[model samples]
Target: MIPLQRPPLPEELVERMSARGERLPQYRGGARELWRDSRTIRRELSAHLVAMAAGLSRCMYCGDSEGTSIDHFQPIAMAPQRAFDWLNHLWACAYCNSNQKRDLYPMDRDGLALLIDPTADEPADHLDLVLATGAYRPRTAKGSETIRIFGLDRPVLERGRAQAYVRCRSMLRDLARLAEHAERAEAGAVAHALTVQPFADVLYEMLRLRTAPRAALVFGAETVAGLNMLKDPRALRGPLHN
Candidate 1:
């Protein structure tokens, strides 16, 4: 999972959502019914979410598979009042939304939610990714709950992430070579490739660990050099910063 930026919705849409939330009868059934009936709200909101999602509308939790549902970060069963609240909404895959998470919302003793909200939290802070294995190691309770709730450690996802890591490293090497040869256009293309792939967390983690204690040993000298090349704003600013 990666940190997401929640763009401001259109003023009209915001007003509509607020009005709908206010009219919801403070019941789970009411929230469900309203969400199901309001086709326009669902359509417009989902479009914006898809536009912001990584790699062709990938799931916000798993970062794999198409995100086809609107998931409430705080479940409607627990917080019906936030059913239409923009901040509570997230784009998710059908598996993560319906099969894994459902309406479960575990909380700590202080009443804070246990699950990690990708938009509000930096996932790397709570979870560490093993690039070679594609497994997530939980560094905090929130990370543990997120993995459990999303089934992020499933074999297929692990395999996919590991594959993505290999591909991203190769692309980075190509990017570094392109940069060395003063091929700015080709370098930009390679950088864009890194951003548009599935399991974007792989590339993100590689970049994050570029300066770690044993980065050279983990990423290899060529990949480490490639990562260093990315430090120049001209290298990845266009694709990554956008």
Candidate 2:
């Protein structure tokens, strides 16, 4: 999963939430079964959740890039308090978020969240996508439970992930080779280019698995590793001439 940048909320929007929080009755549900309430906080949050889901147009659960919907990674039945928790709300695709991740938040707190929080942290920090198996590994235990809860490996999701994984790894490999053989300036130039404009955007796509376009993972890891190494070539090369 790629790291996500949380968009800032406008002042007016924040005020609306604040007013609602202060005036509304306590949310009577948990994360699992809040959607059924049509007259309470659950109902109100459901509208926002649906709005967020509609806004994404892309699935938050599997990054399918199609058939997006508001997905509750944790069943609405189990954790009702999170019914309106903004963080708990995710825009998902019909397949991954709906069919696979039906109320499955590993009851064990051996880890944190099962689904990716496009707001809290970067997915790439803990998870790595394997192209062949369409699975992810938390480079940590916390990530493992997160993966299990969200069902990141549904057949459709896996295919999308695998496609992207292969593509990204391939790009990184090419960049790495250039870094090793190209002149210092040339290497730096390429690295800098990747960090900005198309390069950085492309990397972000690899980093954010929940939204990456399907069939884009035909790349490899060498280039990605190379870019990581090229971080400030002068700092790296300065030590070599001595």
Candidate 3:
């Protein structure tokens, strides 16, 4: 998961949610009923907005499947107070929302959410990609629970991520070869092309090997060398860095 900027809710929408919260009972059914009448829900749940916020490509959770529905980060069943809160909404695939993560929200001792908020945090902090198996390894308790709750290591997802990793690695190797004879400008163009691929996280993790602590141990020498090669001629710089 990557860090996403949470969009602000309009004042009118916030007021509507506040009013709904004031009158709604703290129960699943009541939360459902309250949201059914919410204008904010009506507006925000539109197809285009959901698609845009959901990255218009893949599921936020698995980052592989097509994102098809809106998910309540704080399920309405557990937190009726946030039933219509825009901040609690997320874009998800049908499988992740209905099949894997149906209303199962674990919490910490402080009552804070244990589930990773893809929009609020960098998932790489808690999770790591195992390129060999195409499975995710938990780096923290939150990551472990998220993997379990979302079935992130299910065979289908594992296969998909593995395929993506292969494609990402192939692209990196291609870029490295091209950088040898290509001008700095040409190498930059190659890196830009890499970003447009599906499962861009694979490319990102390899790039992060440059700065992340113990990155060589985490990602290995070849991965670090590939990224360093790209950075040598400034080929693999982020858009902002470039």
Candidate 4:
């Protein structure tokens, strides 16, 4: 997962939600019932789609699967006050939203959340990727908790991530060959392969390797960022690695 900027909600949707928030006390179970309303679902759908687009169409929690639903960073049952708050919403896949996270919200002694909210914090601060296994290991308490809650170490996700890493490594190897021959056209094709989504975390790691001994020697010591992805290979890493 990576830190993401919250997208803007439509002005009218914001106003409508604000009005609904104000009327929560009038509802049967306050914000609990509000979360079940069709109007609320409509507005949330809009926001979820916007967040998905902003997040490269990936789940905000795992950063792997397509974001298929709106998730409350603080579950509605636990934090009614934030039920309609834009900042409390996130784009998530079914696995993260329904199966793993559910209504579980663990906190610290001081009442701070242990789960990493990608919108509020950089996931790199908390988590580390095991490149060989394609599994995330926690660098901090929040990272560990987020991984546990979201099942970040699940076998399916691990396999998917491993495949992504293989793709990224394959691209780097091709770029290395292309560099030897100065094959600009083939290099450009290899670069395009790196940008294809689903597991950008893998590509990101491959890019970072430009500064590392082996990859740097393969690409060149003086790595150009954007241009290298197109003309060579450099930069990429793993929390989404820092």
Q: Best-fitting candidate, measured by lDDT?
A: 1
* List of clashing residue pairs for candidate 3: none
lDDT over C-alpha atoms for residue 25 of model 3: 63
Report lDDT (Cα) of residue 117, candidate 2: 64
Candidates 1 and 3 compared: the better one by lDDT is 1
- Candidate 4 lDDT, tens digit per residue, 39-133? 65555665655544433578877778877777888998898888888888888888889999999999999999999987789777898876667
TM-score of each: 0.93, 0.52, 0.74, 0.78
- True-structure RMSD, every candidate: 2.0, 9.7, 4.4, 5.0
Put the candidates in TM-score order, highest first.
Answer: 1, 4, 3, 2
lDDT, residue 146, candidate 4: 92
Candidate 2 accuracy as lDDT? 0.50
Query: How many backbone overlaps does candidate 1 show?
Result: 0
Cα lDDT, all candidates: 0.87, 0.50, 0.70, 0.70
Give the alpha carbon lDDT tens digit for every residue of 10-115 in model 2: 5665555455444334545432323443345444444454444312344544454543445554555665444444565665556666556676666446555544
What's the best-to-worst order under lDDT? 1, 4, 3, 2
- Relative to the true structure, candidate 3 reaches a TM of 0.74
Give candidate 1's error at residue 173 in angstroms: 0.6
Q: After superposition, which runs of candidate 2 have C-alpha atoms over 4 Å from their true positions?
A: 21-56, 72-82, 107-115, 165-242
Task: For model 1, name the residue pairs that clash.
Answer: none
- Tens-digit per-residue lDDT, 105-200, candidate 3: 999899988789977888889999776677789999899999999998899878876787777666555666666666546656766665555455
